[model samples]
Target chain A: MKHVILGNGPTGVVAAETIRKMRPHDAIAVVGDEHERPYSRMAIPYLLEGKIAESGTLLRHDRNHWIDNRIELVEARASSIDADAKSVTLSNGEVLPYDRLLLATGSRPVRPPIPGMHLPEVVSCWTLQDARAILDRLRPGAKVLQMGAGFIGCIIMEAIANAVGKTGGSLTVVEMGDRMVPRMMTPKASALIRSWSEKSGVEVLTSTRVTAIEANVPHAGLLSLVYKAKNTKERVQVTFGDGSTRLFDFVICATGVAPAIDYLRGSGVEIGKLGGIVVDDHMRTTAPDVFAAGDCTESVDFSTGELMVNAIQPNAADQALVAGANMAGGAARTRGGLRMNVLETFGLISTSYGQWWGAEGGDHVEVVDEAAHSYIRLEFQDDRIIGATVVGRTHHIGALRGLIQTGAKLGADWKARLQADPNKFMDAYLATALSLA
Target chain B: MMNSLHIDASKCTGCLQCEMACSYENHGVFATSKSRIKVFDFHSTGRKVPYTCTQCAEAWCMHACPVGAIHEDKALGAKVVNETTCVGCKVCTIACPFGTINYVADTGKVQKCDLCAGKPACAEACPTGAITFVDASWTGLDRMRAWAEKLDTNAPTA
Candidate 1:
C-alpha cells in the first residue's frame, strides 16, 4: 500500500521513521519542500552567534539514509491534495497515489505588514533562505537592528549582537511589549532577562512600539526605525527604537511563525481556528485515510485539556510517533502532548511547559531579587501547581516541570521553600507532603 | 606541540550536550548561549553547524591587539586572551573573519574557545561523535579513511 507523508520537518520525519519501524514492508514516501536533509530548526540563533559552522548541525539521518531504509523522499513542494482520490500533487504537477497521508507542513514566520517591509534589509527568520539572506548583509562594521522580543527574537538579538559586535558593528533590539518573552516568562522572569542583556552589552528597548520602517538611502545601505515609547505621545526616530535613530546594515524581524497549511485548504480537511489542521486524539485527520502532525496541526494541552497550537520540536516528535504507529496498524495513541520550551537567553535557562502559564488567574505568588537580579513566581489554583516562572538562579527547573506534568498539588508549607534556595526546593516536596498528610 | 581542537559538524544532533558541558565547566552552570561553542542552523537547507575558534596558525586576533593582551598558549597552541590586560576595545573582533573572538562586557574581557586548556568540553559532550580531539598532524585521517572505503579493487561484484 502506498503511504505518503508531507513535509520533512520534525513531525513529518519522525512519522516516517516510526512508520518504517512498525511495518518494514510497507511502501512509504516522504515529501519535503526543502531540498536539504532534515536538520534541527531550534539551532538557528546559535548559527548566527558563530557558535557552530555552516553544516555542523544536520539531522540525525539524511535523505540517503531514509532511502536506504526503503523510504522514498520527494524533494519538492506539495501544493494540493485529492482526499477523495487519495492522492496529493507536488508543485511540479506530480501526483502520487496514497492509501494513507499525513500533513506535517510546519509554521511560517509572522511578518507584520509595516511600510518599507519590502526593503532588502528588513526580513524575518524562518527558513534557510531567510538566514542566508541575512548573512549576506552581515559585513564588518555594519549595524544590525532587530524588531520583536519574543523567544526567537530575543535570542537572535544576543546572537546578532555577538556576531555583529565582534566585527565592530553596532546592535540594538526594539521590542513593542513592556517585557520580553511574554509568552514564555512572567514579568519577574523578564526582569532577569533585562538585567542579563545589560551585562551582555545588548541595548534593549521595551515598552516601545515600532510604527514604521524606512530604508535609509542615498546608499539604501541602512534602515531607520520609527517608534513611540510607552507613556509618550512623541513619534521618534529612536534608531533602534530608543531615541537613537541609527543607520543599520541589516534588520531582522524575528517576530514568529505560524503553521503552513495553504495546501490543505481545498482538500476538505478540517483546519483549526488558530490556522492549523485539526486532528483527533490519535493525530488522525477528519479525512478517513489522512493523518497529520507537527506545527501544522492543532493539539490538546496535556494539563488544560484546551485545544492549542504547539509547533515546537518535542511535541512534533511525540505526536509523529503516535501518527506513525496508528498508520502502521499499531495501537498507539497520542493521549496529549505538553508544550515544553527550554531556552538559554542571555545566561539563564528559561523554560515553560503545559499550562504553567496564563494571563488571568486568581491565585498567584510573586518572588524577586532586589540586588542580584533573580525572580520566581508560582501561580496555583485549588492547591495544584498550575503555572510558574523562575528567573535568575532556578536550580530545580526539572522539579517544576515534574510537578506541572504530574498535576501535583502543593501544600501550604511549600510556600516557605520560596525563601529557601531554589536547588533546595526539591527537598521541600517531601516535607510538604508529610505536613499535609 | 600545541594542538587545536577540530570540529566535525555533520554528526551534530543539536542535543546541546556540548554547550551544557562547556557552561558547566566554565561557569558551573548550564547555559548554552553563554558557552564558547555555538551551533548555527540553516533551516531551509536543513543544516545545523557547531562552530568555535579555529585557533589559526597565524592568529590575526593576537596581532590585532594593541596591548599584546591576546597571546599564544604554548601547551594547547591556543590564542589566549588575558582578561586583566584587555581594555574591551574590540579591535581584534573586527579583524577576525569568523567572528569567533567576542567581548564579554560583564567581566570586561574578550572570550573565545580556549579548548578548555587542551581538554575541550564540547568535543567530550558531543553525544553523536561529531566532534573529537586529535593530534595536530592527523586531522585529515577521518577523510582518508572514508575515501579508503571506496576502493573496490578486490571486491566481489554484486
Candidate 2:
C-alpha cells in the first residue's frame, strides 16, 4: 500500500513517523512544493541578517526523521487532486495514487494588492529563496521598511535591524497597530516593548497605515513611503510613520498567509470559514478515509475547542502524528491541537497557551521589573491557566511552558510568588515538569 | 613583536560559540548581542564569518578618539579600551571603518575585542578552528606553511 501524504511541512514530517511506527511494511511517500529540504521558515530572517546560519535553520537536530521512517519525499507542487480516484496530479504532470492520503498542504504568503508591490524588492516569506535574494542586497546602512505587526513581521524586522546594525545598518519598522504587539500585549506591555525597541535604535511606527510602496529600482536608492496615523490621520515628516515620505531600500510583507487548498478544491473536501479544510476533533475531513492537518486544515483549538486555523508549528506536528497513527491502522485520534506560540523577540521571550481572554475579559496579573527591564503577565480566569506573556528576562521559559502544558493551578500565593522572584516561578515550572504538583 | 587577532571568515560555522565565549569572558554573561566579535551570516552563500576589531598598532580608533580612551597596551601589544575615561560618544564607533567598536547601552561604554589581554577566548571556543590566537606579525604563517608543504618539489611532474 502506497501511503501518499500531501505537503512535507511539519505536520507531514510527524505523520511519517507515526505511520512508520505502525505500518512498517507500507511504502510512504511525501509530496511537497518546496525545493529545499524541510527547514525552519520562522528562522529565515535570522538566517538572512546573519544572526544564525542558514544551515542551522534546515533543522540539523534529530537528523534521521525522514530517512529512518522510510519516507520518500517528492519535491514538486501538487496541481490538483482526484478524490474519487484517490490520486493527486503533480505540477510536473505526474499522477500518484494513494492507499491512505493525508492533506497537509500548509500555507502561502499573502500578497496584498498595493501599488509597487509587484516589484522584485517587495519580498514576502514563503521560502528561503526570498530570504536569500534579500540577503544578497542587505548591506550595512541599508534601510528597510516592513508592512505588518504580526509575529513573523516582528521577528524578521528585529533580525534585520540586528543584522544591518551589526555593520551600522539603519532600519525603520512600520506597524498598522495601536501597539508593537497589539494582539499579544496589553498597553502597559506595549509601552515596555516600545521602550526596549527604541533603546535598540529601532524606529517602531504603530497605528499608521502604508498608503503606497514607491520604488527606485535602477538607482538602488531607498523606497519612498507614505502613511497616516489611524487616530489623527495627520501627515507629518515622521520618518518613523506619519512622514512626508521616507526612503527604504526594500520592503518586506509580513502581513499573513492563506492555506494552500487549491489541490483539494474540486475533491469534495469542505473548507471552513477561514478557507482551510474543515475537520473535526479527530482530524477527519467531511469525506471518509480522508484526513487533513496543519495550516491547511481547520483544527479545533484545545484552549477554546473552537474550530480555528491553528497554523503554528507545534499544533501542526501534533496533528500529523495523530493523523498518521489512525491512517496506519492505529486507534489514535487528534483530539485537536493546541493553539500555542512560544517566541523569543529582542531578548524578550513570550509564550501564549490556551485562552488569552478569560471570564473578566482578559483581566490579567502582571509583574514589572524596571531595573531588569522585564515584565511577565499571566491572563487567567477561575483556576485555569489561560495565557501568559513575558518580556525581558527569559532564563526559565521552558519551565514555565511545562506548567502551562499541565494546566496546573497557580495555588493561593501565585501572584506574590511570581512578583517576588522569577526563581519561585521557575520552581513552580520545575514542579510542573516533575509532575509533583 | 606586537600581536593581534586574525580572523579567517571562510571557516566560520556561525555557531556563535566565539560570541558566547567572548561575552562570558568579558561581561560574565552568555549574551551574543553584547559580544564585541560578531558572526555575519551570509544566507545566500551559506556562510558564517566571524568579525571583530583587528587591533592595529597605529589604531585609527585610538587616534580618532578625542578623549584618548583607546591606547596601546605595552605588555599585550594590543589597543585596550579605557572604560573609565571613555565618554561613550561613539566617535570611535563611527570612525572605525569595520564597525567593530560599538556602544554598550547597559554600561554606557563602547566595547570591542580586547584579545583577552593577550590570549583570545574566541579562538579557544571556536569549534572549527576558524579563529586562533597566533603571533600577530606572523598570522598567515600556518597557511603559508601548509601551502609550502603542498608544493611537492620532490614529486615528479604530473
Candidate 3:
C-alpha cells in the first residue's frame, strides 16, 4: 500500500511514521511546502529568544531520520487532490498516486485587510523564514511592536520581550480584543496578564487596532532626525484606529491563522463552518480513502459536543494516529478532543480547559484575586465539572483537566462545598470520582 | 564535556508541553503516561519539578541490569537501553534511586531518558528557559553569573 501525507508538520510527520511502523513495507511519502525541514511552530519562540538555533525547531533532530525510517520527504505544495484518480498534483506539475492519503495540512497565519500590510517590516511571526526575517531586522534597542494577544501572540510577545529586555529596547503589544487571549481567558484573568506586562515595563494596549502601516519619511536629514526624534527614530510608522501614529522598528502580526485547506477546493471533501475539513471520528473525510488531521481538520469538541478545530499539537498528534491506523485498514476511533490551552506569558502561566466559557445556565465558581494576579473559574453542568479557566495557579491544572476530561461528577454535597470554598476541588474529586474519603 | 538537564523549578508552569514532545519523539504518540521525563507537580506548594534520569557517573541502573541491556554511551554520557537485549527484568527500574526508569508493558522493556542521543525533547519543548541542557561541569554557572555581575568592579582593588 502507498500512503501520502500532506503538510509535513507535526501531524504529517506523525502520520507518516505511524504508517511506517504499522505497515513497514508500505510506501509512505510526506509532502511539505516549506523549504526547511519539518519544524514545530511551538519552538519558534525559543528560536527567537536565541535559546535554540533554527535546527532546534525541527521535529526530528536528525536530517536522515525520515530516510532511515523509509519515509520519503518531498518538498512540494499540493495544489489539488484528484480524488477520482487517487492522485495529488503538486504545484510543480508532479503527480503522485496513493492508495490512501492523509491531509494533515496545517494553518496559515491570517493577514488582516489593513493597508500596507504587505510591507517588509510588517511580518507575521509564524514560519521559520518569518523568524529569520524578524531576526534580521532585530537590533539592540529596536522598537518592536506586536499585534494580537491571543495564544500565539502572547508567545511571540514573550520571546520578543526577552530579546528587547536584553538590549534595553521598548516593546509594545496591541490587541483589538478587550484583554489578552480573550477567546481562552476570562475578563479578570486577561486583565491579570495585562497588569503583569505593565509591571514588566512593557506597554500593552488592549481594545486597539492597527489601521495602516507606512514608511517613515523623515522630515529632516539623518543627523537632525536622529537628534530631534531620538525616541521615535524607527523606519516605519503605524497609524492606529484612534487617529494616532507611532513609529516602530519592527511589527509582528500575530492576529490569527486559518486552516491551509484551500488546496482541497475542488477535492469534494466537506469543509466545515470554521473553514476546516470536516472529518469523522476515524479521521476520514467525506472523500473516500482521504483522511484529514491537525489544524486543517474539524472534529468533535468532546466537552461541548460540537465540532470545532482543536489546532493544538497534542490533539493533532492524536488525530493523526487514528487517521494513520484507519488508513492502513486498522480499526480505530477518536474519542475526540476537548479545547485545552495553556499559555505562559512573561513568566505568568494561564490555562483554559474544555468550555472555559460556562455552559448555558450552568453553575460556575469564580475565585479572583486581582492584586495577587490569580484567578480561577470552574464551570459546571448539573453535578459534573465541564470546564475551567485558571490563571497564575498551575497546581490544579492537571487535576482540573482530569475532572473535565473524565466528566467527573461532584455530587450535590461536594458541589455545594465547592461553591463555598473552591479550593476543595481535590476533596470533591476524591469524594465523587475516586470515592475516597 | 558531558551536559545535564539543568532545571530551575521556579520557572516551570507545569504546562506539560515537554511531556507531549517527549512522548512524540520516543513512543510516536502524545500520551504523557508513556513519557520518560515526568513533571512532578507539588500541588500544595505549587511547584513543578521535571524529573528524569540524571545519568549519574556511577549509575545504579547499569549495575542492576541483569541482561546488561543498559550501557553508557561514552560520547553523550547517557546510559542508553538496548531494547533488543532487554529481558523485561525491570531490576534497573527498582535499583535507580530516582524513579526515572520504568518498564513499558506494551514493549515489555524498561525505558528511561537517554538524553534523546544528546538532544532531549523536554529541554527543547520548555518555553520559559527553565529546563536548559547545559554543560554538566558548570550547571551552576548561570546562577553564579547573576551574582558575579553585582560585584563593585572599581570599589577597591585591595
**Candidate number of the best lDDT:** 3
| Candidate 1, residue A196: how far the Cα is off, in Å | 1.7
Q: Tens-digit lDDT track for model 1 on A1-437?
A: 77899987666766787788778899999888876666556556656666654453344323376767787879888889999999998999999899989888888888776666677768787766677787777665667777888878876666666666655666677777888887777777787887787678777878775666665433222232222122122112224335445556667887777889888868999998878888997788999889988788888877677788876555676677778877887666665666655556655556555565653553666667747666666666656556666665433343454455445556555554443443333443322321111
TM-score of 3: 0.73
Off by over 4 Å in 1: A61-64, A166-168, A219-246, A358-362, A393-396, A411-425, A428-437, B1-158
**lDDT tens readout by residue for model 2, B1-158:** 66656677678877999999999999999999888787766453565667676664325355444344577777776778887656444445533423467667577567877889888899999988789887766676454233322311111111
Q: Write the per-residue lDDT of candidate 1 for residues B92-146, one digit (tens) a residue.
A: 5533434467655466456787888889998988888777887876555444233
lDDT of 2 by residue, A1-437 (tens): 88888887657766776688678899999887777776656556557656556664553234575677688989898888777888888999999998778998888888766566776667786588888877865666666677776777766666677756745466677777788766656566667767776777888878887776655423222432222122111111223335457657677777778898877777898988988999875667887678887889887765676788756765665567667777887655555554455444565544444554444553556777765667777665554356666665433333344354446566555544554554455444423323222
TM-score of each: 0.67, 0.66, 0.73
lDDT (C-alpha, whole model) for all candidates: 0.66, 0.65, 0.76
Query: For model 2 chain B, where is the 10-residue window of minimal lDDT?
Result: B149-158
Which pairs clash in the backbone of model 2? Answer: A50-B41, A141-A169, A223-A248
Ranking by lDDT: 3, 1, 2
User: For model 2, what is the C-alpha lDDT against the true structure?
Assistant: 0.65
Error in Å for residue A405 of model 1: 1.5
Question: In lDDT terms, how accurate is model 3?
Answer: 0.76
